[model samples]
Target: MGLDSTPSRYRRIVEEHFTALYGSAFGRLGQVLAVDAAPDGRRAAVLGEIRSAWRDRPDAVLHLVDLDTGATTRLGDGGDVCPQWSPDGTRIAVATGGAARLVDPDTGAGTPAPPVPGVVEYLQWAPDGRQLLLGVHRPAATGGDAAPVVTGTGADEGARGLWIWDTATASVRQLTVTGAVWEASWCGADRIAAIVSDRPTENSWYTATLTLIEVAGGQRIGYRSDRQLALPTGAPDGSAVAFVECWCSDRGVVAGALKLLDPATGTVSDVDTRGVDVTDLRWPNSLWYAGIREPETAVGVVSGTGVDGDPARPAPASTEVAPAAGSRAGEEIWSGTDTIGQFYPAVAPLPGGRFVAVHSSYARPPELAVFDRAAEPRTVLAAGHDGEHRVRDRAGTLSYVDWSAPDGLRIGGFLARPAGTGPHPLVLHVHGGPVLAFRNRWQLGHPLIGLLVAHGYAVLSANPRGSTGRGREYVDRVVGDMGGADAGDLLAGVDAMIERGVTEPGRIGVTGHSYGGFMSCWLVGAHPGRFAAAVAASSVTDWYVQHFASEIGWFDVAFLGATPDTPGGPHFTRSPLSLAHRVRTPTLLFAGADDTGVPPVQSTEFATALAESGTPVEHVRYPNEGHVTRGQRAILDQHARTLDWFARHLPTG
Candidate 1:
């Protein structure tokens, strides 16, 4: 089958089909961040954007969607804000313009509530709705465009801390002075629990502690995990604080380990969650959670936990969810990987066991939906990005495909292939976080993924060793073995597909961002000639360079198990740049101008080495993009470039 891989044709398809649905590198996209169910469940307030965010504030618009009529109304605009519903649901608490306010959901009017020191992220409304607990991130040392994942610095001005805004007095006060606060929640009216670090750098968050800050005075360290902690939700009665703890390579993107702490008693225990890695949590009537159970993403309730279990005895404190043996927990009411109830699988608890989640599937665009524990979901507000369906249909079938690693471990991933496919050229797409996974969550909606599938190139997105959904042992295995078995697992996946008559040898291309980018470069370099072409975006081509340059240097130190200073370390051996001389595949490199996580130098260094090796290589940079390219034009350009690169190399039919 002959395919047209011209830049204009691919660019047009991306603009007309994808730019409208997901977003274009230029802008103009609606995103739903947080969903709050009204007291009556007739309406929900979504905290996000009705327009392009560009990762900048003043893009936040509080949208009120009537569940019955499916009508959406924007309350107002804000600089940087976290929107939360009052207990009574009469008003919404939001922080914008470096200040907090109470917004009338019906009238779209705002009541000022004094000013705070910084931009608000995670927040909570007091039980009585008279106060707001804000997770405020102060400005960076530069005092311009702060909060992105950048290198750690010593006690700079930029630090995330907690704040309390009293709506009654229209005043706000700082809660703590030391240690930057991240995910936070209010405990009753007098206490707050948060994930905090003594340092404000992105690397420090890897070891941040879960602390309980008292509104009365002192803060106490509640629980400190060797692994990362996040999504601390306070029980309504202020009895316990629940959080998801796990071995995470990246902050914000996490899964598994639902642990509860009774602050008064100072007793912390695991909420037996079978084996599922809880990604997000909500403490309503029951300790509800959304997480990944390998090939499936699920939302459920932890029944044996204090809330639903016998209050006479709290669950036993144990590291049951640790790197060893454990079973899945709670009642898995809903299971599937869609973009819903997310701060990454965010679930908004509605009244009477109903939940409203932002839904997106392999074929569906993002939209609001209501789901009961056992019943199928119904859309609340249509996302209006229906153009994706046609692309989905022609993009072929999406399924979870697993293959045995070279070492006998099973590696799972999502695969999309053309309809009439018999050993089609497979495009391996790697996810960013060695910690993140591809859960069939409308990834096909992505212009690049869809364009490839539409062009008869099967896509393989792996959840190989370091990915979540498989538990701590599985994820932590990548720590000292970043280039070892993890690389073999993905290469073995291509072999599995080959054995299954899915794709033949010498016809595959590889693409990824971040660690995936590292792997793409890793594969082409370490295991030469396995891939026909490679596109590494925001990549780490040289571990030695990455350790000194990347924002989270600890990531390299921790994952590689050796410092760059270590003589003859894997940092020197595993880096793609070390093997660049062996790369015969034409490689295309991409990076963001503003990225600090994996600096543009990471890409340029590899490009330089590849040029020295006489291997065809090109480096492309997005001016306004960051670690992840979210720009409309930038993304579109990436799609066109990726298709063009692969087309010139890989065999289609």
Candidate 2:
């Protein structure tokens, strides 16, 4: 049963193994999307979706899990949005279609709230639970010879705005007459603070306004700023509001500040975060809880007792608290160590010194974990079962590794290797979201890593300079220099891996999707002799074409710092297609046929270029897919093609 002896049979065996492993892993960890802890923190309402079979689509459902007993009670079908737990913990509100529904966590009974005008985006319970803040979308007004215009601030595409649902009166009132409301929180019984944008563009973060509105009179007071403001959390006592303010350049948020705003006077003061990338702001009590992503992801807390200082006072000294052992008066509660990755781990402060969160690692699936001062994480809901154990038994071992780049910047990544000895054929897998990091979560998006390792290949997934786990400065490094330092950092990581004798020279391959796909194409072209083969899926080839065709075309200007038409700009010089003539490695390109993010034309154009340059290349476009393939058939076919492509180009013994 060697690689060359029975190619089809060998491939079939590999596919079957991968299918079983994927099914087991997928089932073991029910896809927990959002988790909201009860006010008391004794239990949590988990909104998740799971597919029993490959052909089946995931059905959304809510589960009430007892933290102490590990008892999970299914609460009817849920929507594809976050479920809000009432302030008093008596009811849970979820958006379903154009209306909001209230579900009794214990009884599983649902009460339909008053229907809104359009599709419901988000539902937030008022402080007293008498009203629900409904983010909904209304169709754009159209007339003769005019195209329908979509507007609004809802997460979905449309004309989105804010609406108030009065529970007692069973009435709905439009809060904002125009513009899209990004996020809102109740400041008091009669006032609400929200982030609103005049234009409903995808890049609203850079143009939104933070406003305090009187609910009854519709009197609005807003602060005007060019910086991006987000994740606004109102104080429990309604004295102040805190939000994340990001300094925006042509690129995205380069730096951020956790600022406190006085609702009465409209004066904003900085709450010192020591200049870290603070996100997921929550005001549970007198303390402000947020997740800090710089240095590494950890829970950060600051006292809000005196946050509403004098309006004319200079911003107080940095309130940033370092990771400490015990929870003192002003210390932050750091979760576990820096070695593990926690991607936006949700934290809910409990009555005592306890906190509950959904935690996961490279080797661990997400599970409900409770934390305390003892520094030990106790799992309340186990995400693994026999299926998970079976998959883990055959899975490769994962370890964290880091190396200094050419520019003295430290780069980090995770390496997964098979059990056997000697230098192994290596596959350098790149992650997308130039802003997103290669975290320690289960590699559901890149399951091919497991399949390749099972067949005797070392997989190296690196987080280069622009990744988010580091601070904003590190993330902003790739802004105007997308393919420069970041690409060098990746090459340096590969060199370090080979230097450590973990990978065989000249037997290396590369693959990635989205921005990662761009990297894949750039890697093979930039270092023509380095990799034996390349797979670039949903990749951007020419910045000019991508700018006009993609939904996030604005990203081109943000990242490249120039429009496509800019004369002799990096948009053309740094694009992978510019160096396509140098590519010697056999390449495989793929994309979703209907992808609006990185349109399939990206792959088509690159494939055409590679062919014209006499490079061995193959192109695949999955039909009815978007930026990423979703259907089970498409996923399976993609996996098989990828495995078979790698095996053919870089054969293993």
Candidate 3:
């Protein structure tokens, strides 16, 4: 049967795979992404999952998790994220596979309302809660699938437009026929604010001008902005919009100022808020934005007033902004110091102008704590599990440690020591995104790490040079260097892990997805004897071919620092094929057939090279997964096979 043909069988296969691979329940369950307060405020609209619910499943169904009783109700067939609670809070609007649906929160039943045939992303409920707005790429009838809007590529095969869908009537309208538009905010029932760019250039994030557009007339008035404006959040009064404006800075554009935009007057001023890039922004009476400036993570509150596109006066200075109660942006939030991992933090607004930040540590599961602003020295609502039995069955201490690279740059990583072991086999878990961070948050069904640990193996996840959370400089460290400094940092992390008594030196293995996959391939080739085995997933074997082959339009130039057509060529020295002769490790290569990001060719080319060199190698490809192996069953199976491969090659405790 096809992958999605039978959910029951798939779940069984995944469970069996998990048991065979992990041999322990480290409590690695699935994660919930979207949550909202119910109308009565007694319960919450939580869209999460149970691990076995859908094995080998690509996307998740919208499930309503009751806050009070922790009861869950599945909402739709599948393919959902970014669910929003209506203003009245009776219903919820969910952005699923390719459509927007309105579901009754109490019943968890939705009226099917599919979006136009295009990629619709970042959905928002209108102020009146009557309509939903989102960004979509509507391709021309003749054109094929929407090509990624890359940096230098001028081909606009799809028309990027603002789509407004009325939930009551299921009527949809194209607000703005602009391709470079991003992040729409509903000012009122008739007016909308969006970031638009006429002449788009390659930038890290969305770099566009804030524009106010009238839905009925298709009239557009550009809000004055010297730099790009993003994360546009409408005020409570629906009169003014507060957003972060990107300014050119010496230390890089990591810092941003809160600005009130006036569409009528075309005026934009720098408000009192000044800090790192705004990760999440919300307006609950006061304009609250979550900012992370590396060593210091703080939330700045701004207040202002304006309407009809008129500039407003700046708010008072933000004085007592602190970390999100239980959040540690630089250290605890991420799993390690050098590498970037995934983190799911709960930002729940509490009573009396406070917020409760709940998440888990690498060594622990989910935990909750309340943050009180009035208390002196900030009292802790809950210090979380006291490192007791919570981690007893866990492989090892999920400790955050740091090390210095050759250039004096501080690198971070997570060292998961084996449960009952002296010196265990070491496995380096390389992260994807190459730019994203790996934070210390709750993770469920982490097959690779959990299975390796259960098998008496020490796992190390490191954020080398290009990882985030440290600073903008650290994220862009591998921008121009790509494989150079990042590879060195990974190597250094392994060396440091061994010196720190985390694992044995001779029994080291490395594995990564996407960019991390490239590093794994590079590691096997660059330092031949350093690792006993390597697993490269959806990696980049040849940069020259990947510039046009990749799905993301801007990734090539943004990461490589040079376009494919540039004089010196595809920029950096990136070719797993060239280093194939040096790989002596028993290697395993993995990829998804449908991965548009790093296509299967990357894995195929490397596998071919290893086989041609007479090196021990194994290759496996999933039918429809994207860059990473994400289907519950697929991921479980991949994890089981990976652990088996590593165990057979690397020395076990």
TM-score of every model?
A: 0.91, 0.87, 0.77
Worst 10 residues of 3 by lDDT: 331-340
Off by over 4 Å in 2: 1-29, 139-157, 217-227, 246-257, 272-276, 286-296, 305-330, 337-343
In candidate 3, what are the lDDT values of residues 215-284, reduced to their tens digit? 7766565564544466677654445666665432111122344566555455555554333445556554
Give residue 59's error in model 2 in angstroms.
2.5
The per-model lDDT (C-alpha) reads 0.75, 0.70, 0.60
| Winner of 1 and 2 under TM-score | 1
> By TM-score, who's the top model here?
1
Model 3 deviation from native, Cα RMSD in Å: 7.6
Report the C-alpha lDDT of model 1 over 165-259, residue by residue, as the tens digit: 77787778887546888788876668888888877778889989989988888888999877788888886667778888877777878786887
- In angstroms, give how far residue 476 of model 2 lies from its true place: 2.0
lDDT, residue 292, candidate 1: 75
Candidate 2 per-residue C-alpha lDDT over 179-298 given as tens digits, one digit per residue, 9 for 90 to 100:
677678876567777878775555554577887877765746456665567766676556667676654422222235566677666666655554445656655554445444533446
Candidate that would win on lDDT:
1
- Listed per model in order, the count of residue pairs whose N, CA or C atoms clash below 3 Å is 23, 8, 26
